[model samples]
Target: MRVAVVSESFLPTVNGVTTSVARVLEHLQRRGHEALVIAPAAGSPSEYAGAAVHEVPAVLYRRFPVGIPTPLVHRTLADFAPDVVHAASPFLLGAHAIGEASRLGIPSVAVFQTDVAGYARRNRLSAAEGFAWRVVNLVHDKADLTLAPSSAAMSDLAAAGVQRLARWGRGVDLDGYHPRTRFEPEVAQLRRSWAPNDELIVGYVGRLAPEKQVEAFSALRGVPGIRIVIVGGGPSESSVRRALAGMPVTFTGPLHGRELARAYAAFDVFAHTGTEETFGQTIQEAQASGTPVIAPRSGGPIDLIEHGVSGLLTDPDDPRSLARAVTALTGDAGRRARLGEAGRRSVLGRTWESFGDQLLSHYESVGARGPVLTRALRKVDVD
Candidate 1:
């Protein structure tokens, strides 16, 4: 099957959406499916997983670039004539791709990965929150089928009247991020550099942006024998650095591949402060690395973690709650080990192969149903 993937975010941008898309494209190629990527200009390689990537012009927005649709997009899709269009977090370029697909009577699928309404509210654009929801509804409603990464996100979209909603979870590279990686000499040395002593290491990985609520991590400062390691970079790095001043915190610009895996493996406790996440990929990666996580009790973490069972979920609005969770997990090695092991076991089956197969199955189902029948059935199901 020929699949055209449209995304506003891609290579050169280290985020969950790009990571997921890259893995999916690789899986598609391994399975002998023709895949093409249409993404914003991020100096991305011309070819990925043997799939040709078409870079569209984009403008810088907040932390990353937002793709703008051009006539070339229509031409590319027209020439390739994909069997289905997969919009990975369809917003800018994705929105255009879906529009063109609709014009050509092509079946398209949109994935809801970001919370636009929540973002607006976080940025103090409260007046624009309703407008953001309307835009979200417009885009997802246009697609033949829309995929939400978490149940919480699906519920939000349903409440907003978005149609044809379905759940599509994320996958983790277990082999790349296992407890065994921590035994590597290089990883051990990396940990020494962060702590320099046998201090507890609390880690956070993701964009250091305002929406991520990274500032809340400062609450972990001044805790006895605890060092905070923040991995990843963004527009808010300077502010984070200033906010965490005089604390035992180390900011590693950005790490990928083995380096990224080592960072996760070295963590004594992984912390995520973001509450607007559709799905927290870092939380899964940390678990895959055999590390206990402390994430907020809101959004996707609520589904990923079973409080006090696999990992601890604290109050999203309380920084002190996050600090307390970290402190409690740090002092109890036995409990932390149990939670980490269970967390790893929980996601053992969530491989990239399974994710790709499920996505392909959805595509086939939507294709077989056809647009008219699919929409009619979706309406009946939603009604």
Candidate 2:
């Protein structure tokens, strides 16, 4: 099957969207499907790795320096003639791709990855928040099927008027982010730089941006023997660092593979304060690595955690509350071990392979919308 993936974000970007898409693309290739990734040009063609990338041109704003804009649709998509267009987000590029798919009688699937409505308020686009929500709903409404990473996210889309919404939950690479994965010597250097002693290492791994509420990392400062290690770099790095000026925290640029796994393994507790995270992928990785997570109660964690059972979820935006939860979890080794076991158990069956199979089932259902892409291509050859 030929699937065209249209997304506003892709490789070279270290965010949840990029990570999730990369996993899906891997499984798609393993299943013998050809997937074309269409995103804003980040670098040379070789930068795309395995998948074929169509780089459109766009300027990125300073604050959100990592985001690439695709203001127009590329004509190459029509030439390739995808069987199904899986559009990620309803941004300009994604909207253009989905529109073309509908005009060409192609089946389309839309993945709702973020809450752009909430983003508007944080980004000072309050008046446009409703507009963003409506545009996203319109895009998904036209899709043969729309995917949300969590049941809560699916409900959010459904309530916002996306009719064909369904859950296509995220999957973690158990091997990639496992307990045994070792740390880089630099990470040990990092641990020493931050802790300098036998301090309980608490961590947060994600974008260090305003929307992510990174100030929550600063809340654990002076909490006796707690050291914060924020993995992954972002536009908000400098600001987050300034906010934590002189605190016992270390910023390890960005880590992958063994270094990342070690970072998770070293964490006595994982913390995320974002209220709008649709599904926290990092949370799953942390939990899968036998680390107890402390997240806000508002969005993603609602699906990934069971509060007191597996982990704790406090009031979103309440850093003091998050700090208390972190303190409690890190203070009790028995509770941390208990939550760690339960957390791993909770995510045991939710693997990427299972997610791919689930997605393929949904694709077969949506791909059946027309005579199917294969049959259409065969007719062209016979002609």
* Best candidate, TM-score: 1
Q: Lowest-lDDT window of 10 residues in candidate 2?
A: 63-72
lDDT of each: 0.88, 0.77
* Alpha-carbon deviation at 372 in model 1, angstroms: 20
**Where in model 2 is the C-alpha error above 4 Å?**
47-50, 63-74, 122-126, 182-193, 368-383
Please tell me which predicted candidate would have the highest lDDT against the true structure.
1
> What TM-score does prediction 1 earn?
0.94
Name model 1 segments beyond 4 Å from true.
Answer: 123-125, 368-383
Please give, for residues 1-383, the per-residue lDDT of candidate 1 as tens digits.
77889987999887888998999899999999888999999899998998899999999888588999898888787767677899999997898899988876568999889888988877778779989999999988889999998989989999989989888998899899898998999888988899898889999999988879888978887688899999999999999999899999999989998999999988999999998999999999999999999999988998999999989999976779988998897789999899999999988999989988999888987773343553454344335
Determine which window of 10 residues in candidate 1 has minimal summed lDDT: 368-377
lDDT of 2 by residue, 266-340 (tens): 787888878889899899999889888888897778999999988898987466897788778766899998998
Q: How far is candidate 2 from the true structure (C-alpha RMSD, Å)?
A: 3.1
User: What lDDT does model 1 reach?
Assistant: 0.88
Query: What local lDDT does model 1 show for residue 248?
Result: 90
- For each candidate, give its TM-score against the true structure: 0.94, 0.90
